[model samples]
Target: MGNGVKAEIIAVGTELLLGQISNTNAQWISEKLALHGVNIFHHSVIGDNYDRLTSLFSLAQDRSDLVIVTGGLGPTDDDLTREAASEILKKPIFEDQETMRNIESYYEQNGQSMSPNNRKQARIFEGADILKNDVGMAPGMAVQKDETLWIFLPGVPREMKAIMEQSGFPYIQNTFPNQSPIFSRMLRFIGIGESQLEHELRDLISAQQNPTIAPLASNGEVAIRLTAKAESETKAKELVQATEQQIYERVGDFVYGYDEDSIEETVFKLLKEKNLSISAAESLTGGQFVERLVTLEGASSVCNGGVVCYAKSVKENLLEVPKLIISHYGTVSEACAVSMAVNVAKKLESKIGISFTGVAGPDEVEGQSAGTVYIGLYVDGESPFAKRFYINGDRDMVRTRAVKKGYELLYHHLKQKNY
Candidate 1:
């Protein structure tokens, strides 16, 4: 690869622009390209009109050395990428007999009659390399036209991903041997700020060359993506891992997860592994906390139930929070939060119970101001601990922030307790 093959993504489906189907394929391809250090210079989304598609293809050819196109490989009339590609490149399309036999056999096995247009699925460029679609009948192709390499893929997400992982990634690797592939690892950290986290690892960030550190913000959390470029994939990962180790040595405690690891996922994995279970009492979250936890597979083993005590009466009556305490301290107090947590665990028959109680509001409640929040955790044979925050945001933001803080505390507590 030469200076990491410059690439452009062209999504060829009118349905995408029409908002009928999302262009999820672009995101998948872009992430895959990033992993290999491919630089995506442009992302062009065009509809089914052949003239516009051809013009877009021509423009891509002039600007990028490698153009990745998704969609328009279907057997219907709207599927026009292959035809447009042949016309724009002046390459004759011919049926691949092997692919044709596979398609025919697929239809026969399903006991369905093949449509006349299905024959178009077997067509390829005059001297193009065929990419097999294991998940679907439509065969993808890689063709060279006007010094630009074009990679065509199906629009269906599963079909596209299967081909990319099994064949497409390898194909691009072989074709672009001169360009260095990009590789990256993301360190997911909670209970840390973007600035503070970087401050701890500023030395590593400032002194960078082959590998670079880029910090990204995600809803109340931060992920520092350590990207490294090298001719070999193994070398690139080694570079990333080395950088990650140095950073982790400084602030690994705040690091709760890694790439694609959400707080909920981390909680579920740890709980499942240790054969532990959890339940929640959501005052501000309204059962949202437990819903997020139990959404993962096998969560039923740990997650039993939850309560949404949006009102003082519910907290007092349903969760056994003393009505006298609420009358004195209101529903958003630390006592109320602790009670909610303890009671919910008893009610749910879970090993642990957590609760959210706060003024997640645009309006003040009782003596508390908007953004005033409390999170309580109650584990078996441990004291119920509550943390308070005075976050400044809108009503939804405050509630969401409070919910995330509860999980972060839960994650840290569980990690410390188990280890």
Candidate 2:
């Protein structure tokens, strides 16, 4: 039998339509609902137009047992979710005295006067359960009518996340006692094409059911998301792990990090664990290499510093690369790349040094073609290593690929030491 509650997430916001902000709320709600055994069939994003929202709501009620809406719950006139919801369901709404008092008290606590328009936030559908919002002024709500449940949450991510975790999730779990536990693990991979990875795991994907293997490609990277459904989380995880082991036997070597692993984060972690410090001398990547490294916490422990020597003179003066090397081999040459790494490591007194110098372009530089990248990596107490790659796509693509390659280089170096 199908799960009793088939839910649909409706993100009501004009800005979402205009691409002013992503519909991240829908994604968050989907994950939350899945944990509560709520089946999310569709995700719909509609602007704040009342007529359109009413049509969307009617469709949702017809097909789904539960409708969860985020956004358009603000106090402004354009905040039309509640208005549209009230009209579509033909449910008369009144301001809950408790919510109104809370809103007033919030303003009082902050030493600010409440606007008359802010009173709109206190209104709820008659007989609906009021869900308090500890994060914001507008109170959330859960309405029940004719075997259908509607939950309204604020658009703000922090506010929506808090209310869902604290109130909405537990309430739904209690309401639906026979909910299955949802489990999934993402296997991240690099150094392989999606087509190639799929080809290797074709046998596994062909034979999936309760535990499913889905391979997906994003940007230039590939991943396999393994998911399972079972009565309990432990059983679900067992189901997933069984399939993961099978896939691993087939194509595990290509796998890098699991779930959400930023290339830089993985590299940084490895470098820190190994007690290795790195410095950078950047050219085409500008400061992107160092910028990405510093983005992670505890970067200072693993990074000495970097010199973004974009100019030929700066490379010679600041990074102290030999003038003869640049003049003879040009900046894009392996010699220049290797020298950039070695000299910067000496200058910063760091053990490991990495360098990115290349022609990324709408046009080529020196005699080198566009998308021609050379990276220099020098580990402390070891001879330096340099790799040359021809990356495809435009200027930004070339730069992005270069950064990913930089991470791959560091990861491989760390991996070799462990082995």
Model number with the top TM-score: 2
lDDT (Cα, 0-100) at 155 in candidate 1: 84
Clashing pairs in 2: none
lDDT of 2 at 190: 76
Q: Which ten residues in a row have the lowest lDDT in candidate 2?
A: 170-179
**35-122 per-residue lDDT for model 2 (tens digits):** 5567889999999899999999988888888888998888899999998899877788898899999889999999999889999999
- Residue 307 C-alpha lDDT in model 1: 86
Overall local distance difference test of candidate 1: 0.85
Clashing pairs in 1: 1-177, 1-178, 1-179, 36-182, 37-182, 277-302
Per-candidate Cα lDDT values, in order, are: 0.85, 0.86
**Count of clashes, each model:** 6, 0
Off-target runs (Cα >4 Å) in candidate 1 are 1-4, 18-22, 95-122, 272-275, 367-370, 391-397
Model 2 lDDT, residue 300, Cα: 97
